[model samples]
Target: MKMKLAATAIAAACALPLQASADGEVNIYSYRQAYLLEPLLNAFQEETGIETNVVFAKKGLAERLEREGRNSPADLVMTVDISRINELVERDLVEGIENDTLQNNIPQNLRHPDGKWFALTTRGRLIYASKERVEEGEITTYEQLADEKWDDRICTRSGKHPYNIALFSSMIAHHGEEATEEWLEGLKDNLARKPQGGDRDQIKAIHAGECDIAIGNSYYYGNMLNDENQREAAESVRLVFPNADGRGTHINISGIALTKSAPNRDNAIRLMEFLSEPKAQQIYAEANTEYPANPSVKPSGMVAEWGEINPDDLSLQEIAENRSAAVKMVDRVDYDN
Candidate 1:
């Protein structure tokens, strides 16, 4: 996706392309940037004739919703990370939406038990290892990241970031905090350097010979292949879906929810149902370089080439419950230092 908005243009416009509509409409407050979602939203409008309005921001949509209360124009909230979705639910900002289409389209583990939110796309947290130095079968599970055999060889971003927090939360969900704390300390001991930079930086570190292995989300690999500067660096590493033999690889989602005071409730439901269908899922996931939430819908482009993901079955809610504990563990180990 080539989105070339100048910084001034983006700062002034904020939300782009579509303007807020008066009728037969649904308004979206998205943490997902407009460039990443416009193609899919345009498709939704063309198919359903429902006018869609979006306000995209990097942060504070949740606070805005709370401030607006019943007067809010938001019909749906779409964003990355399960914690953000759960945060909306925790604040009573969104309503439970259980329908035949949503239930049938999303798997049981991905949707909330109360039906307040549903996952639209997923990305696996995988090990990206140097193809030349790291043998294919050298690592098989997330537990192995902490092993002394891999000492001073792993690279990753800050442990407190939501992506890593969610992953560590899953570890706490699967293993008690005591065991998780120990594993976290061990993993810290094995880091190639104090955890630093984003997922792309970890891959770049591998390419630059700073480390033999790095941890990153699945889509970054697909994205790297699209960039001329990062292509060779991306190719130097092989994607590994860890824990395939046991609990399965850790995974995260970008999801959607309906606001509690949606002015366009029926139209929003129509849009939600439409988005949950296989056709829309295919378009949406491919555009975002994500695994479609619907099991029957396959990922497209180079993402498909990464091979299939066997995601862990643990409830995302369980992971959310353990998130605070996970963050505390990270600080206790001083992983980011």
Candidate 2:
């Protein structure tokens, strides 16, 4: 019975591409905010005359896909975080895509080894320091966050956040667990307050003079600057690219993949290819203030304003592989305790 079900699903998928109308729509399960993605979807529809439908949720798209099984209507999945994308691949819910356009556009380190997913945008894990308190060049590396000088002067979001967890995982990838734990301890000792709030809140704390330095994704700075209410929250802090002379800046991505049991495989492939194109990539970068996955596409003005720095070039898979261990270490240190 299991064999028969698998055969039927494959047969359905094989038949889907051939039957998919040029004008057929694609349904997307997006973990990203809808406003950030709407413009690109609109452009895609304008170009292809194919409708684009999306279900936007902050979490659980993976479980949704798994539960829906072969009957799932989702053609594509879009999400942030390497671990989430890896989860889809591990569950056999994501299909491998091979396209010359994708290969030529996205760098190898940013894409999955099996072509299961492709990063669309990149965000640096950067430091934000109080302009009045921390002079330029005072903190130049991520390692400096552990220095005694920053004691009780640093703020950050919860370690449980995927962004921080991924950042910690990258540290483990570069440094051994012992060194990484020691660094975390130093950061903990330096905390202005127990980790609370989102990345923006950390910046708010910096603006309020509660902390002299904070860690956040570069795009959050852009987002805060773009928001009317949060503009005040970002006004006092300046962005810093850490480790510029060493391993390079740590980074992560917002990425997409095709669902393995997609009822609209052809539409899924088309959407993926479309996203890789320069126009779509630019829209993504501009809207989110993230570096485009396509090297040929330049970052938007806001991202460019942050200046260029070499990314660490770490394989995103390394972050995913170390995620569990990183979480364990966070608990071991009683990061919140």
Candidate 3:
């Protein structure tokens, strides 16, 4: 799998160059892997007369755009995580656009304050507890992962990974760095083994009885259930939307922004607006097993069965602002050690 992914990435990079958008065309530089974008792109092209062109890369599109300057062909950038999109804003690679469609479809908290980036779908950083061992209500908040009762029982990936960094950033947004530092230390103490593996491995750990609980994104539940080898392991655990009853779950997005030097600004804006509409959002969210940013669009059947999520009201603006401080706290606590 790793070899195939690396090969695919190399091929993608070899194929990518600054594309010049011609009339009625929009060029996209996306961090999202090709599989996730292909279907949506096809639908988008079919729906509108505008031609769609994409270059997929795992990383470094921002630097490429920077090097290309005003000559860059990218009309828009699509990527996951607030920090990644925020980097474009920080580096002046993307620009804010005032769009009534975005304003209507996306909530204020799920968008850039300056209208630079807008969330397309949301996923929660949630708890996965053993179905046999953890009772309903046994854990209620992200803070509970710190309790000593779970000592030597919890599991996670590296604290420095962007997903965890985003989660930690949210902590800073809510409780400040001092408290977040303490929380990280406690959370670390609960680890059953050294922090390691992707989110699905944590579910496999629960199935293997390596631990009674783990931390992961919500979408993995659907993915694991669909994989024949992972189905049983996925079934052995249940999800907890931590803090759902309080501040609501800590959620993040896969989002997009208009490039600063869009050659086809009008077509790019039209694409953005199309994506915000219910039909496109339905395809985008369902295929990814995520909640659409548009409230009117429902999640897939499997996702809906997991239960509704009430996302935290705290601004992603504040959360993105606190990311650097969050990473520092992880180091201070030696969280992955």
Candidate 4:
């Protein structure tokens, strides 16, 4: 089963530069978009003179690493969401990091317990409510999205999407399975149209009047607002930091991990530490509109304009642990149906 994925992923691996074996170079297998990574990598190279190579793909990376094993040229993996980074740990494809800079930069709750992965930036699972239809303060929490008042007034992407799954997992961590399942069922009952599209689509649905409220990540709002074409759709909605009055907003991360087969271990660690520092964290916040994992680095640009978000204090490890149960609950509710 795994080899099939690896075989298919070879096409992706072929996209990678073959010079990772060379000295003074760090190789990365990234799920992050190249546009977002380019600036950071450029700055890193300019600062340290260490060259970086990346193979960007949406899926099949973990299996690719597992297939390549010791011969793999990948020195590090950069990806978003707790589940993805944790998947590397679960497969034993990555190694635990032992660096003081990494430990000092990322908080305990955002990183793996055994030092296998460290988060770079976080995005809130925000509520995007139609400014015209939905009154301010009408919806304040994830629980409220399931309320009867929102019947046929909500839209979302697939419940199984990693972003939504992380939010659902956090819900499970807070409320347990039975209550969360009930909540999922209620949320499903509230859908305006069958759940469809990505996070940005949910916001666009609100602008189109197909739904009055939707769930999406905080960064998408900023991205849309900054774009020429999507600004109108983005402006139509107000960003709600769900559960700000209670348990706080649920957030997922873009994180990094060191591969077990790191051919450039020292350079990889250098890049990792560099990313954790203020300059790289600032680039992440400004360029990507994401909350920096390092508490010392504050969010900038439109993300900062949204004001401070009281992110849920739940450990990402707990969220990752509960993800399977969350997926099961989504299935039990038949959320995509």
Candidate 5:
């Protein structure tokens, strides 16, 4: 009942005209799902007496903001993936932040150098291997996914997906485009079936015996383990941190940024700082099954059980920069075909 009212309020608020510095309220346009933000927003409201109005969608918030320009009601933008947040800056839709609280909480590697964005939590791009088929220590690196031994044994989503693009971009960053293209072609040759579906679908394919290996985000495995219906499929596979012993696993983030037309700037900043703090960070970590960007806070127990992630130290900006080349390379190699 309480949740319904909150949803009602959020819907009503989203419909009204937005004004700057609307008393005791902050508005947001989020690509992140609403259910994930509800608890965190409610907690912030309870603590500060500031209401949060959110407009959630999977895409187009940036374009909407562009259309509204200065009249945009959004105070903040939150979403997953480096490319999405970088899109905001690339379009000049977000404001640069200079808060000590944000700077202190988020690591340099995880935040934009100019403060155009800050990562709140990170999820690893992991290799999920079939437990019954793939032996322990058999495959240890991202490079191994291209090995001839794994021919006709791999599954993955579309090469154009942001998660995979980031991983591919990282490859270009580390090994140069020529080598990365060769790797992509080899990986494509190894696919058991046409690349389709999200990360979870890749895992499902593995469980159904369509493939012996799949690429997925770490949190998907954790979420599946927690879901009764998905547990069996999830348990059929074991988590492997690709490149853990070398350049470390590729990671992506769920991040937030201040919008240029922040009506209630102060309240938005408060929410940002609150999220970066231990309490909210812990809540986010547990809720999403991601590692907290606030290094001081620990990951949820379920995530910690998976073993530590030795994250690639490569600059995320470099990855974002290489995104075009990565996508082009995906096309050039006919990765999805």
Candidate 6:
């Protein structure tokens, strides 16, 4: 609920006191790991001869930007979830982008209305069930997870998780508070264990026979498939695309935005445009196993193997608007209880 901005482009050349050069250099602050974003940045540098500098952290970059203020050296910000993006918007940290290429490449739902941020890649919140335990057709919809039959057979991360919270917000948007609360209560009763751990841990619990079903994002599945140690963790379970018959699967994104006070404004805009291009989108998909936000880009083989899915067409801003209500509802149902 704490709102802050990620990136701002400033006009002042002497803001940060760092050495400035017109050699086409851009600085980026990212919530994602360096390696995941390195390939694209490296490719951008390779293609445009722009020097790219990056600082990566899982949290606190917003506060860091706020502290740095006009003196902030950051020219661009990249992070996951609508909450973080909304924070940037609320704090007036990100600046409006005027690029036509970005506008054409990104769908309206995936970008800020003011053109401050745009989703680069997406992850879906889908069902993961034990292949040996749960029958293939036994569960399909997210609504069905609340059924009494699944009691003590479900595993999940904490409700406070941004992924779960966002999914919950989407549910609220689709289903009224009363219905969502009822579903949450049922889900809480069906929980195999109290919420804990990341998505991979939930899947690992399923493989361990600790639970028959779990909720997770698509990228974690990809990460598991790619990791030598956790490959076995994904082998015993099947991924299910829920709500295919209705609102479609709930989805979230890892996105980028230009800071309002960006020092290297032209370079930052160029980076935004570069990321929206098909090749960069493909690099994001192939490297991270995420679906490209650009509809023109095909998902990588790993994601394709997971099967095709229809994402909920709801706007990303709707998810941000409903996040607080979703968090309150989670607490009301004592989802962690």
Where model 1 places Cα greater than 4 Å from the true spot, the runs are 1-21
- Between prediction 1 and prediction 5, the one with superior TM-score is 5
lDDT of each residue in 1-337, candidate 1, tens digit only: 1222211232343434332335777888888776787777777778878777777776777887897788787888988998888889889999997799899999988999989999889999999999999999898889888899989899999999888999999999888999999899988999999888899999999999999988899888888988998999999999999998788988999999999988888888888888889988988888767899899898878788777788898988889888889888898888899
lDDT of 2 at 27: 73
- Alpha-carbon deviation at 226 in model 3, angstroms: 1.5
- Tell me the tens digit of each residue's lDDT in model 4 across 227-331: 999999999999999989888999999999999999999999999999999999999778888999999998887788899999998999999999899988888
For each candidate in turn, give its C-alpha RMSD to the true structure in angstroms. 3.1, 6.8, 3.3, 4.2, 2.5, 5.3
Better of 1 and 2 by TM-score: 1
Query: What TM-score goes with each of the models?
Result: 0.93, 0.92, 0.95, 0.96, 0.95, 0.93
**lDDT tens readout by residue for model 3, 1-337:** 0101111353555465645768767888788876787677778878776777777787888887888899988898998888898889889888988888899999999999889999999999999999998998999899988999999999898999888999999998889888888888999999999999999999999999999999999888888888899999999999999998888999989999999899999989998998988999999888888899999898877889988998997888789888889888888888888
- Candidate scoring better on lDDT of 1 and 2: 1
Residue 174's lDDT within candidate 6 is: 93
Give Cα distance to truth, residue 40, candidate 1, Å: 1.3
| Model 5 pairs in collision | 21-263
Measured by TM-score, the strongest candidate is: 4
Cα lDDT of model 5 by residue, 13-92, tens digit: 34554554578888877887778887888888888888887667677778878878998878999989999998998999
lDDT of each candidate versus the true structure:
0.85, 0.84, 0.86, 0.89, 0.88, 0.85
Clashing pairs in 2: none
Ranked candidates, highest lDDT first = 4, 5, 3, 6, 1, 2
| lDDT per residue as tens, model 2, 1-337 | 0000111232333333222222477877777866678788888878877676666666777887787788787788889878788889888999887888889888999999889999999899999999999999999998889999898999988898899999999999999899999999998889889999988898999999899999999888998999999998888899999898888899989999998777778877888889989999999899888988888888769788778867999999878889988999999888875
Worst 10-residue lDDT window for candidate 6 reads 1-10
- The local distance difference test score of model 6 is 0.85
Compared with the true structure, what per-residue lDDT tens digits does model 6 show for residues 220-292?
Answer: 9889988989999898899999987778889999999887667888988898899999999999888988999
Estimate candidate 3's RMSD in Å.
3.3
